[model samples]
Target: NATAKAELGRATWKLLHTMASRYPVIPTQDERAAMKQWIFLLSRLYPCGECAEHFQQMLKEHPPQTSSRAALSDWSCSVHNIVNARLGKKEFDCRTLSDVYKCGC
Candidate 1:
């Protein structure tokens, strides 16, 4: 279990680089599947459609810094706190964070 968690931490590190942009943005499908899964796993964190759409556009253009495994773990933990602080407790769907939205694009 510890090893799996460590591998997941590594995956999250790879994901942080590939997932979200630094200036705030939505993410690609691969990114969303990983990062959003982290969100859902956290006791806090929810999705917002309007914010998600806006950020997606941002991510489509600008990318973020490459992340380390330790950095991502810290970042993910902070995201949980930040989301909880901003949005309060509520359920969000995994569907909202990815590029799978039917934009007809």
Candidate 2:
């Protein structure tokens, strides 16, 4: 179960980061609104109950930074580091995000 949960988290973070990487550089207001709603829905619909609750709280504290691809990617890394810290995992360098999550699309 622990393995499955960890794998799920890894996969979810990958998806989120890749999406952030591909997000518009200067998103329209409608795009920004959509991204925000999508993130909120993610917190609400995440498969893991405890993880979802923690994500919801994090959202309240930090909210989504959808102003640009860079902003969203940086915000994603920061929140991911928050979770990593809580799990006693090493923090990822935010500067390496482009290298790490290359969607190529």
User: TM-score: which candidate is best?
Assistant: 2
TM-score of each: 0.28, 0.98
| Backbone collisions counted per model | 1, 0
Residues 1-105, model 2: lDDT tens digits:
899999999999999999999999999999999999999999999999999999999999999999998999999999999999999999999988998998877
Model 1 over residues 10-64: C-alpha lDDT tens digits? 4543454333323125345566456545544431321344435433443344322
Q: In model 2, where is the ten-residue run with the lowest total lDDT?
A: 96-105
Show the lowest summed lDDT stretch of 10 residues, model 1: 96-105
Structure candidate 2, residue pairs in collision: none
As a whole number from 0 to 100, the lDDT of residue 58 in candidate 1 is: 39
In candidate 1, residue 12 scores what lDDT? 49
65 Cα displacement, candidate 2 (Å):
0.4
Off by over 4 Å in 2: none
- Taken over the whole model, the C-alpha lDDT of each candidate is 0.41, 0.96
Q: How far is 83's C-alpha from truth in model 2 (Å)?
A: 0.1
After best superposition, candidate 1 residue 52: deviation in angstroms?
1.4
